[model samples]
Structures are given as C-alpha cells and as structure tokens.
Target: MASIDMDAFAADWIAAWNSHDLNRIIAHYGSDIVFLSPIAEKLMGNGKVAGLDRLRRYWTAGLASQTDLKFELLHVLRGHECLTILYRNHKQQIVAETLEFDGDGKIQRAFACYQLEQG
Candidate 1:
C-alpha cells in the first residue's frame, strides 16, 4: 500500500466538510469505521456511531443542521498510523479530530472534540 500524506489529507478533509457533501466526507472512512463525537449524541442520541450506514445518517443530519458549515484547518499532526486535524468551524469553535487509519489507508476510528465559543 502507498503512504498517505497527512497534509494533503487534511486539505481534502477540510474541503469535503466545507462543501457539505456527506458522500465526499464519508468516502474518507472505512465501511466499518467507528466515529465518536459529542455532536453525534446531540444529533443521533448517541455519542458513538459505528458502521458506514449509521455514520451516513449522523453526518447527513449534521449537514442539514449546519448548512453553512465550513472548516478552516489550523494544524495537521501525523503519527505512525494516525492523524490529528485541528480546525475552526464556521461558528469559530476550535475542533480537533484524531483519526486512526486502517491498513487500506481509510480511517478506521475517529474521535472529535470541540468547545463552542461563548457569546
């Protein structure tokens, strides 16, 4: 398998999110991927979403809720088999997502953290 470039991946990831294209964003993950995010709980009543089907539902709901969503990439940290992406949302919240890649270079597991800014 070929090596994955974290910087390039980060760029594409941000673009995919900013585009609000669920299919484009989901394409980065494996079919059996597990994603953990607080937003998932708020949207799907669960903090952890497993499998592509559930992930698609969760993301579709998110895209619908945040129609003008955009992600501004701040940093990209690369590890042996993981990548940490730091970005600012349209709401100006700082979000960080750490993704672990499968053997095929698809994201197998992902965790997201963010704190919304106070008005």
Candidate 2:
C-alpha cells in the first residue's frame, strides 16, 4: 500500500464517483471487500456490508437514491496498509473514508464516517 501513488488514486477515485459509474467506482476494491457506514446501517439493517456482491448492491442502492450524487476530494491520508480519503458528498456531508488494502493493493475493507451535521 505504501508503494501506491495517492495522487493518482485520489484523482481516479474522485473521478469514479463523479462519473457515477458502478464498475469504475468498484474497480479499486477487492472481491472480499467489507464496507461499513452509518448510512449502510439505515439501509441494510446493519453498518456492515461483506463481499463484492453485497457491496455492489449497497452502492447501487445509494446511487439510485442520490441521483445528484457527487464527491469533492478534500484530503488524503496514507498509512501502513491503509489510506483515508476525506471528501464532501452530494448532500454536502463531509466523509472520512478509510480503506484498508489487501496485499495486492486492492481495498479489502472500508469504513465511512461522517462529520456531525451542523446545528
């Protein structure tokens, strides 16, 4: 993961979400991906989504619901075997999307955390 170029990754990631293309967006993930988010909990009866098939379904539903979906990259944090993307989504919500990479540099686990809504 340390060998990965974050500039390229971030650009491609932002592009993938902005394009609203499922295949492109999912390309960076591994087959055994595990995704977690508060939104997932609301939509899937839990915060965890395991496996590629389930991830596809979860993201598809999200995309369908948020027709104006888009994300703006704000920051990128790289770590050992992990990286985090900080961005603002279509709803103007800030998200810290932390991803753990498999040995092959594919994302195997992810957690999306939101900034508390302003009062």
Clashes of 1: 0
* TM-score versus the correct structure, for each prediction: 0.94, 0.95
lDDT string, candidate 2, 1-119, tens digits:
66789868888988999999999999999999999899999999999999999999999998998889999999999888888999998889899999899989899999999998999
lDDT tens readout by residue for model 1, 2-37: 488889999999999988878899999999999999
Instruction: Note the residue pairs that clash in candidate 1.
Output: none
Q: How does each model score on lDDT? A: 0.90, 0.91
How well does candidate 2 match the true structure in TM-score terms?
0.95
Off by over 4 Å in 2: none
Best-fitting candidate, scored by TM-score: 2
Clashing pairs in 2: none
> Judged by lDDT against the true structure, how good is candidate 1?
0.90
lDDT of 1 at 72: 92
